[model samples]
Target: MVSRGYKKRGVGVMGLRHVKNPILLARAMLEHGEDDLEANPRGVNSGDLDVPSAQGHTQLYGKAAEQLAQQYELELVDPSYFFTQRRWDEHVRALEREKKGQGQATWSATEYLPQGTCGAVALDQDGVICAATSTGGLTNKLTGRIGDTPAIGSGFWAEEWAEDGDPTGSSTWDR
Candidate 1:
């Protein structure tokens, strides 16, 4: 609930992608007290952050977050941080390049596949099945290109459907 959660009392999100990175979480910890908001994950530029072994990202963030949280300090992560003027300018430049038929795909020697979603499927006691997924974005994709993770049935889907393909169970929207 990063949209407005930091303002509330005793409210925090876990595994929720950070707006930029650990700085925000550190700020929250300082304001709300570390005990109120226990654990959270923070990172930046998730769009192109797909390495073969993701632990590298994890380890890097852990060190940064611990330092920031301990001192309630914040630091600029350069172009990676959200809303830096330099980064904004670079985004505009990239858009212009793409419009002119010039775009770079892979960032480095090792190009990872576009696999971003973390998913879970559940079957309740009543036999109702549900699926949920979350993603940061595709790796090495165009800057603003939204990945398939949120594409409903394509990315993540569940539940029974009738012969005609409509949902089998009651839905409030039909009213």
Candidate 2:
């Protein structure tokens, strides 16, 4: 699975995975004392934490994940998103191809991947594990836009064990 450092500080476990649905979670946090809505109107951006991508939707996913965790009473752990570095590289290559007049001329065609993927893993206090992912199909991506995020076993995985036994079970998901 691909991994990267999560930078939005103070996005504790609560801010990370507990707040599923970035937009909704952000609104809730603003009502509470957990987050500053005004300062971060667009949720948390990638640069706030040094991750790549001109933008990062981790906060949005985190919020949605958090709501699910709480609704299910699951103990939230390190909530994160994984995207293939190759996919990003491919996006760049596509831009080059377009620059060479081999592809579409639209700006969105070059600025962002036609689609993106994300995943989340959660564990309960008793150690049950759950994995989830979100993504849009890889339609119309430039030749270089590799769509690995939705690939099974390549995007996300999780493991957990019973308190009194061997590993209880594991859950995995693809976009």
Candidate 3:
């Protein structure tokens, strides 16, 4: 999802869950959030097409759900307009260089990203399956980069299976 905040400053933490277990993570995230900018930057040289919504600091856990109601622009580029203008510009320039194949390339995107994450896939006594994931995402990640920790199928998934063994579990992607 193209996470964005309608204000110059907002939140950045993201969560995706198929069950209620992940709410715990959200509660914890709320406690750790800090004041940060949360605007959809414009005019940036989004050479890689990954425009970040949060600059300097990814909002701890606000403004993500708003993406659902946000109209998908045909080509949302340039992560500018953030409250920390200087930092946003520097990062965007790096992103542009990366797109031009002149910036650092030895490390994969995940290497520099925040690695601490929590995920759960559980089957309860009632045979109910649930899944959820939590992450702050890359505090300094490339714009618009979707981390596996929050992606539905790629991060965490859960499905119920029949005792007959004729059925298989599925993810949101499969559905």
Candidate 4:
């Protein structure tokens, strides 16, 4: 599961039971469906193809991924695998803070806050760029709220680039 969120950002992936790493899961989901994209030219390099609705994030913690896992012979661990004393302690602290009205005031502090996502961006050996990210979300949050991390273009996005007139290859990419 993508994990739950705070008042600002909701849990992006809900009810994830056995998956250990969402980043890897997200990457797997991408790689798993890349062939389908390659076979269909209409989706190639199109942002629409990379959108969240098409990325299958909505199929979490249910029959869809479970069925796929079974078909692929993938191992599914108990949700207890995600349990940790440290995480529980953090959740307790967050709740205490909220009760005292000491919670964070802004969502923009995500990168610097105690809770945040992990991401990796790389220019692969084939010169193809790819990015991936995942988060456990805010502690003691609503389990059904999906955070931005699993929201495709919001938390992670990659697109091929080519410069038409820049010979020095110094053009900047902007969202």
Please report the candidate that would top lDDT against the real structure. Answer: 4
Model 2: residues >4 Å from true position, as ranges? Answer: 1-100, 103-110, 113-116, 142-146, 161-175
State the lDDT of candidate 2 residue by residue for 31-142, as single tens digits: 2322322232233765433212112223323344454335334454443443467666865765676677755553454445545456666555755555555554453455
Better of 1 and 4 by lDDT: 4
Model 1 lDDT at residue 158: 61
User: Candidate 3 lDDT, tens digit per residue, 33-121?
Assistant: 33323445444674423223323433333234323112222122233422355545555665766667765533445335344466555
Please write out the lDDT profile of model 4 over residues 79-150, one tens digit for every residue: 888778877876666666666776753222432346556776667577666665666677666667766666
Reference-based lDDT, each prediction:
0.40, 0.40, 0.40, 0.50
Model 1 local distance difference test score: 0.40
lDDT of 1 by residue, 1-175 (tens): 1111222222122222233444255235434452443333444655432222211121123334444334344443443443445445544555565566655432322323334346666666765555545555443355545455544446555645335433855555554
TM-scores of the models, in the order given = 0.32, 0.27, 0.35, 0.61
lDDT measured at residue 16 in model 4 versus the true structure, 0 to 100 = 60
Per-candidate Cα RMSD to the true structure, in Å, reads 14.6, 15.1, 15.3, 11.0
